[model samples]
Target: MPELPEVETVRRTLNQLIKGKKIDHVTVHLARIIQRPDDIKQFEIMLAGHTIVEVERRGKFLRIIMDGLILISHLRMEGRYGLFTSSDPVAKHTHVIFHFNDGTELRYKDVRQFGTMHLFNPGEEFQLPPLSKLGLEPLEESFTLEQFKAVLIGKKTKIKSVLLNQAYVVGIGNIYVDEALFKAGIHPEQSVNSLTDSQFERLHNAIVSTLSESVEAGGSSIKSYVNGQGEMGMFQHQLQVYGRQAQPCENCGSMIEKTIVGGRGTHYCPKCQLYK
Candidate 1:
């Protein structure tokens, strides 16, 4: 699954590719991928001639802005998008295609068929499920140490679990949770409330730095993830502990360990992130 950085990178690339392109028609190869309006045909009919105003990212979802309606798309595990001329042959596993007036098509391909799209009125998008319950954006200036500390108050769950919860903060996933916790030198299984002020500050900084750096690097492409232009991210080459199990820690030279935390595969430096 693409985390915050990957999703943000998609938004940036898609905006550049299709921001002003007008949708002449839409074709849905898989009906179940469209989850909005409950009627698949109506979803296609309404999008006709709608101009692509811009693209936005909320949590792990993409909001393709239009005139009065917003198309919220969630790119699950294997979802990827690419822009191609209409004359190009459609590739296998292509699920959705947004045909633009300029003879170009934006294709959505997902091998797992787990991607979802929901259409909602502009005013109702933020008040509904998925977008409504999400917490502060870690990449934004509002997600300060004080704001993060507030989410940890009275929480006894493992720190990794808390960070993975979208209700606490949006855009965090297993990869980032493990990487950020490792950078902060905090054990993934440590209780949230047990963190001191210094630890809290370090964790906060780690999360932001890890995410922002990944975004700057165009996001990690450990899997089949790609940008709107079919470009793979380069951040995976710089990862420290996420997938470096049994590798020597870059800082302390301790062997990186892998364990299951809250049902997710977690990696960290056991000696550096020693539990209290």
Candidate 2:
């Protein structure tokens, strides 16, 4: 799944491509992907004739701001968006297509068919599920070290599980969680309460810096992820431990190990991130 950096990169690329373009029509080949209004026709009618005012991202969800309605889209695993001329042949997995008045179309393709779209009225999106329960953005100024520490108090869950929880910190998935934990030199299986003040501070800084650097590098392309322009991310070159199982660690020359933590595959350097 694409994490914060990948989603932010998609938002940036999508904004550049589709912003200000009027939706001439909408075709939903997969009705199950539309979760709002529970009616496919209503979803199509509400979106037609409205211009895509802007594209914003809340956590991993893409907010397609239109004239009067907001379309919230979550691109789950194997989901991608691309812009192409109307004459271009639609791909086999293309699930949704937003035909623009300018003879271009914004297409959403999902191999797993797990992507979702919800249409909501302006200002009402955050009051509902998914977005309502999300925690603070790590990149934002509001996510201070004090707030982060406060959220972790009394939590008995493993640190990896806690980090994956959207209520604790939004937009972090397995890939970045492993990367962040490895960078902080904290074992993924450690309990949240076991972390000391200094460890928490290190973890906080690692989370922020890892995400910031990944976003600047266009996110890690570990899987099939790509931005709206179909460009692969460059951050995969900077990965420390994630997906480097059995490979030599750059810092200590020890073999990077992989283990299951909280049901997710975790990678770390055994010598660096030793269990406490």
lDDT of 2 by residue, 94-177 (tens): 999999999999999999999999999999999997589998789999989999999986788889999999988999899899
What lDDT does each candidate get? Answer: 0.92, 0.93
lDDT score of residue 52 within candidate 1: 88
True-structure lDDT of candidate 2: 0.93
* Model 1 per-residue lDDT tens digits across residues 201-246: 9999999999999999999998788888888899899899989999
- Give me candidate 2's TM-score against the actual structure: 0.98
Scanning candidate 1 in windows of ten residues, the lowest lDDT window is 222-231
TM-score of each: 0.98, 0.98
Residue 93 alpha-carbon offset, candidate 1, angstroms: 1.0
